[model samples]
Structure formats: structure tokens, C-alpha cells
Target chain A: MLKPLGDRILVKVDEEKEQTVGGIVLANNAKEKPQTGEVVAIGTGERTPDGKDIPMTIKKGDKVIYDKYAGSEVKYDGQDYLVMHEKDVMAIVE
Target chain B: MLKPLGDRILVKVDEEKEQTVGGIVLANNAKEKPQTGEVVAIGTGERTPDGKDIPMTIKKGDKVIYDKYAGSEVKYDGQDYLVMHEKDVMAIVE
Candidate 1:
């Protein structure tokens, strides 16, 4: 039930098994691995310089790929979610 | 004569003496030290989601303070300048 603001979106990060190699733990935060998430909520879109509201392209329930280091991590009701701007999202999974 | 694009602005970085202490030099790229520059050229402003162009707040010859690590370095006429988005600018010095 988290609501984002200003072109930001609330996302539920998909969980995946950690990758390891030869008894070495690979870093999970590398830039090469883009994260996927399900959009839970969206903001009211970004405002134009003239104070006009711009509509958002991505909608709730859409799957999206985002930048590795995008968004702020927020814990809501014992669950973790990310609140990031729309620009951080690279593409929609369709 | 480099013009920025999409809410980006070109800046002429002000030259200052590098700080040195006890034969040790402090890293010039620290976040605490915000950089100041004069606005040179700016892009046509960022486009709204509906394809409308937003007007820029900063103007040419304005002295502005920007984030330490903001923008890309470029050389024009053998002088160093930064090309960065307007959001990277913290404030305009009056």
C-alpha cells in the first residue's frame, strides 16, 4: 500500500537465487545484472515546468527492467520494495 | 560553443588552487566540495511526457553551484567545461 510521488513507481523486486562460482560468492549488486520487478503503484506523473501534470507511461501490474542502482529501498509491512523514477526503468517486459 | 540537450547546460568551471596539507593533497572530487561554474550554453530544455518543451530556469552567464560529480568533462578551444543536466545544479549564486 505504498504510494510513490512525482513520476516514481513502487516495485516489488523479483527474488532470485544468489549466483556463486567455485566457492566464491559473486557480488549481487553488479551493474551487468539488471533487476526485474512488478509495478505495484505509480505516482501522479512528473510535472511540467509550467505546473502541468504529465501522464505516466508504465502502469501498475506491468513488469519492468530497471537500472542496477536505481531507486530507494523501502520496507513496507514486512516486505521490501523500491521507489524509483520512471527514467530509471529501461524497458517494459511486455 | 557546445550546447547541452534535454535540460542540460554547459558550464565553464572556475579554476581554484588545489588544497594541500602536510605534503598531502586532498582529493578534489569529494562530495563535500560543490563546484561552481558560469552557465554558458544550455539545451532546449527537457521535454514533457506529452512532447512539450519545458523552459530552463538557469540563464547564460549565471553563476551556479552544481553537484561535485555531476556532468561530463569536455574540452572546447583547449578549455575544460562540463555538460550536465539542470537538475545537477544545486543553486544559482546571485
Candidate 2:
């Protein structure tokens, strides 16, 4: 399990395609991978340039929506994960 | 256009339903909305509890993925938008 640092978060992406959602059964070459994901871990908080602490508004187990193309992607323990800043988050599910 | 402040970011959510990905034509009640979005705007950066400045890694025009349920959604000019901390961002698109 990868733990994010700072105000960064780690997410496990949900599969993009499902049989119920599709009709054509597109092959892997044509299938588009889902860029969306679920929150797996959250960072401690933000740090000031001067090394001060900034409180975070989000916590673990929260679902969020963000820009499709943001943050850094890394593979750990044979699984793909994302690590990014909290500011990149855009909305919370109700 | 909505301007995000601090480490907050604004995103324009893409529609969850698309013909290419589905077959059943699930009704609105059964269809799941896509929590993912595109970055429309970005905040200046993060602020320390003491009010110091913290540089942000993400910039405007960057796409990202975040927790499915992580931000505040606001309607501006009849368009839906999300505002959240940058730390909430989990990944950046290559």
C-alpha cells in the first residue's frame, strides 16, 4: 500500500468499462481506460515554503473529482496509484 | 469564468454518459454520473496556517483525477463547476 505525503493523495482507479455499459465490446486497443478513481489514501497536509503546517479539508475514504490529467502516477506493489496535491481536487460527491 | 483562489481549482465536469461506452441505455435513475472532470482553472497556490505562500505543482489546463467525493460544486453562469484544494488532486495525465 502506498502512502501519500503532504497534502497529496493516493487513488485506486475504478475500471473504466463494464459489460453493462457497452454494446460493441470494444477491444483493448480501442478501449479507453478510465481516468477517474477512488481515494485510497490522503496526505498529512500541506507545507509552507517556510515549513509551516497547513490543515487539509479532506480525509481518508472520501470520494472526489478532479482534472483528468493531473498529478504524478506511480506503480507500487504491482498496482497503479496516483499521488497529487489536494488543490487539484475539484469536487466532493454529495 | 470562475477563478479559483489559494490552492483551490475549478473544473468543468464531462458528461458521464456516452454512447461509445454503453449499450443498455440505462435510465437516468440507473445511470451513474462521471465524477471525473477537466481542469478549467487553478488556484494560485496553498497558504500556510500562518498565511505564508506555498507553490503549487499543478497549473491551469492540466487534467487530474481525485477522490470521487471531495469538493464543493457551484453553479456559475448556468454551468457546473467544482472548487477544491490542490492537495486533493491524485494524478496528472501524461
Whole-model lDDT values for every prediction = 0.80, 0.69
- Which lDDT tens digits does candidate 2 get at residues B35-87? 55678888777677867767776677776665666689899999988887876
Name the top TM-score candidate: 2
Clash pairs, model 1 backbone = none
In the range A1-81, model 1's lDDT, one tens digit per residue, is 777998899999999767889978888664355577899999988987878778776789988766678899999899999
Residues B1-93 of candidate 1 have per-residue lDDT tens digits of 444555778899998777889979888764468889999887667767676679999999999999889976655568878777888999999
Give the least accurate 10-residue stretch of model 1 chain B, judged by summed lDDT: B1-10
lDDT of 1 at B42: 77
Q: Which ten residues in a row have the lowest lDDT in candidate 2 chain A?
A: A26-35
